[model samples]
Target: MSRSLRRGALAATAIVFSIAALSACGAGNDAQTLGVRPDNAAVSVDDVKIQNAVVITQPTPGVKGPAVVSATVFNNGRQAQTLDAITLPGTSATVKLKPAEGTGPITVPAGGSVVIGGEGNATAVIENGTEAAKNGDAQKVVFKLSRTGDVALEAFVVRGSGYYKGFGPSEVPAPPSATPTASATPGGEHGAEHGGESSPSGEASHASGH
Candidate 1:
């Protein structure tokens, strides 16, 4: 090789070695590294691909409470579609496409994704969840449509810690039940349960009046 070319090659080798050393020093030093993306699971049926799917709630979204699920539903097809209803057959919670305002299904723009149940914006809402609604379980959910057929997906149950903890089952007070307690016998009885007839001194007033 030429003199200048040989020097250029040696400099490039040193730079490559330095870059490798930096990478080795910074192993697993990201801001946050999770074992697996539990919330980033995806399921595809037909041309529809649902990504980052997770049902976020406390433990259970109590009766009339909220069972929120978030996901990015992508329409790989050429046309637009509307998500009519979402149902959790494994749970009692009914799905709503519009949580803020009670309404019908949400529309998915053509070749795009619709984000449901994000932070502060709860799009698909499930009401009236039961004890069976727990965390770390795969819930069998169905997404209904107007024209297209229903699509079933396994949505994971993500437990709440900070912001989404309110959806857990409420600690409602149980109804009061009667319980027996110790009490003295009726009719002015003393500490003793059974006492002899009243003494003459204890029963006097009428004779004195006569």
Candidate 2:
């Protein structure tokens, strides 16, 4: 081939290689490249963002007990926000909040964040929860805030094992046992037998003497 023709062929080969490389790079930017998304739930309402929300229960499946919620709340506004309460819809369970700073509402600092049910952090518990939820289930949780109103999300229910070993609800005290009463025994019958009459032999001897 002539020198000019050879140069043109080389340029065409270089262009083909460049196009193939560009296609490969585009394919690499798919969902897998972003890494694995968290298995928990997340939601944003107004200036508040709740992320990685999950309900953790006892490791035993279907066991009736309390469950704890874990999440991080981010406040993007200039003012701090208070987390008032949490609720589980379509269930009889009640959600109780316990702030890490003792007895008060949980506060998400301005332009900062707060963690719920994390180590040494505030807690949100679902009383008598496992009956309405089980491991591997999706439960609807509502977070009531002072400024953002109510933000709801579908949180995943996970067993308190593996990465969530300490996320389960605190130990609940058992109800007191019923005490025994005097009426529960045969005390009345025994008293009647001993007090109502003297011995039969004693009574007969006294009648003979008379």
Candidate 3:
């Protein structure tokens, strides 16, 4: 090769090596150097089971009253669900859906869900039932709809009964059967008597030990 051409090639090779070394060093020093993009990060909402939805209060739009609702979200999947945000469901000048505090991007653990209550404290709002009634015993809560997989899609909210109540609001406590209780005997006593063995406490004894 010509003298000038060889010198140019050598200089280019040195520049490439220096760039590679800088890249490696920077990557090792900080996580930002890993070339991660927040916009491309995976976020999903799945296994969304609505539990105990209720309307605690109503909203006030100008002279019109407000429509408030509440419900619990159950996560029945193995992965965590991050609720990005919620938008009002229907178009009613008099109606509005309110977003609760810390409503955006909530993390629900696997095999678990979060309970959303208080009509006035909803993450988003939607129109339910007829406009004349101006009351949503139940409305469609469409999720922002994103998943760990590529592309953020749309998700629909299923309709179910027993999710709404009147102005009176009460927490839906767990079922009584879920509570733990002590074992009992058939005779209403503490222990069971089988084959004259009496209780395990050895309270009753036979004369011959038989």
Give the winner by lDDT: 2
* Per-candidate RMSD, Å: 21.4, 22.8, 21.7
- For residue 85, what is the lDDT in candidate 3? 49
Query: Could you tell me every candidate's TM-score relative to the true structure?
Result: 0.57, 0.63, 0.33
Which residue runs of candidate 3 sit more than 4 Å off their true CA positions?
1-46, 54-66, 88-104, 119-133, 136-138, 148-210
User: What is the descending lDDT order?
Assistant: 2, 1, 3
Model 1, span 1-210: residue lDDT tens: 999999999999999999998887665443123222444566677767666566655432232234566666667777888877777885667765563234555766677666665433326655544343567788877777554558777867765434334322223211133122214455554523333322111110000000
lDDT of 3 at 170: 25
Summarize candidate 3's per-residue lDDT along 1-210 as a digit string, tens digits.
Answer: 999999999999999999999988887765334322222112234455543333333222112223323344556677776655444355331323233444345554577655443333333233332242234333343444244322122222222123223212222222334322224444534333342232111111000000
Prediction-by-prediction clash tally: 0, 0, 15
RMSD of 2: 22.8
Model 2: runs farther than 4 Å from truth? Answer: 1-37, 172-210
Question: Which of the numbered candidates is closest to the native, going by highest TM-score?
Answer: 2
Better of 1 and 3 by lDDT: 1
Candidate 2 TM-score over all chains jointly: 0.63
Query: lDDT score, residue 100, model 1?
Result: 29
- Residue 136 accuracy (lDDT) in model 1: 72
Q: Which structure is stronger by TM-score: 1 or 3?
A: 1
